[model samples]
Target: MTTDGCVFCRIAARELDASVVLESATVLAFLDADPVTPGHVLVVPRAHLPTLADLDEDIAAEMFLVARSVAGALRQSSLRCDGVNLFYADG
Candidate 1:
């Protein structure tokens, strides 16, 4: 499932080392390498897409759903957290 030039795809495929937090059919959530907060997770689609517009609707939806689940998990975890901020840019 790893794509040649996409780092996220490689991580999704487990070809790259990432502190994975959660994974589903179309999504992979992992700890950010350089995080601003303790439980900062990077939720990504398994598809090799550089931009949001390039992602399929189903995959995009799955990514957000995974993000929500990860956020809930983070909040429940020992990490001190009150809220979650999910951000993405089209380009």
Candidate 2:
């Protein structure tokens, strides 16, 4: 369910640019262009459904699988932190 002009779709086709981290037959992972933390990443499906209800169970499972892998890597990564701190600058 990719949009006619979506950034993720372009990233998938290589028509646009992105710093991909992980990729599988059905998924791709890239660093967050606007990150909330030092090493924030984005794990998205090759398709652009926009919502989980629009995706099949298999795709959802794979998405979570990628997230799990990312989490594992983060745990052992040099970017790992002992505690997570949250703050907001919005007013």
Candidate 3:
């Protein structure tokens, strides 16, 4: 399910434009419009989960796995980053 006005949901649904980096059945990873770092990306589940507590076990695991993969790719790229940081924001 998705929330009516949730931005992430819009992106996931292809209703909004995003620099999509990776996409799976349950998750979407994309470049942040307002990134904290040069290669900053956001990983989110397709469902409208408002908080961590709202995520199911399988979806949560998939989210982390996708994030890890993205992080690795960023480190290997010419972004000049020694490491990657994953940030979670829920509200």
Candidate 4:
């Protein structure tokens, strides 16, 4: 979907409240309010791109870089983390 009025966009724009963990010029990472597990986060690009294929290379790279950093932080946290799983959902 387009970024206009999108919930993610709102979060990125700071119009919505989110427990943000990491943010860069191109990406935003925040805690999922209804997390399936503790520390669960949703990392997204500031620009609205419906699917991975739609994302420009640079933005996609930045998004994954942020995701990696988040996972690393999670692994280093006090939580009993066994491993990290990454999932991408587009709808």
**lDDT for each residue of candidate 4 in 11-69, tens digit (9 for 90 to 100):** 98899999999999999999998999998999998877767888899998898999999
What tens digits encode model 2's per-residue C-alpha lDDT throughout 1-91? 4378877788888888888878888888787788888667777778776665776898778877876777677778898556433221121
* Candidates' C-alpha lDDT: 0.84, 0.72, 0.91, 0.90
**Weakest lDDT window of 10 consecutive positions for candidate 2:** 82-91
Candidate 2: lDDT of 4? 89
Cα displacement (Å) at residue 31, model 4:
0.2
Q: Write candidate 3's Cα lDDT for 1-91 as tens digits.
A: 5498999999999999999999899999999999888999999999899899999999999999999899888988989897787778976
Per-residue error (Å), model 1, residue 45:
0.8
Model 1 accuracy (lDDT, Cα)? 0.84
Residue 88 of candidate 3: its Cα lDDT?
Answer: 85
On the 0 to 100 scale, the lDDT of residue 41 in model 4 is 92
Return the clash pairs for model 2, or none.
none
* Model 1 stretches astray by more than 4 angstroms: 1-3
- How does model 3 fare in lDDT? 0.91
Residue 88 miss distance in model 1 (angstroms): 0.8
* Model 1 agreement with the true structure over 27-49: per-residue lDDT tens digits: 88999889988998898877777
**Shift in Å, residue 18, candidate 2:** 1.4
RMSD (CA, Å), candidate 1 to true, equals 2.2
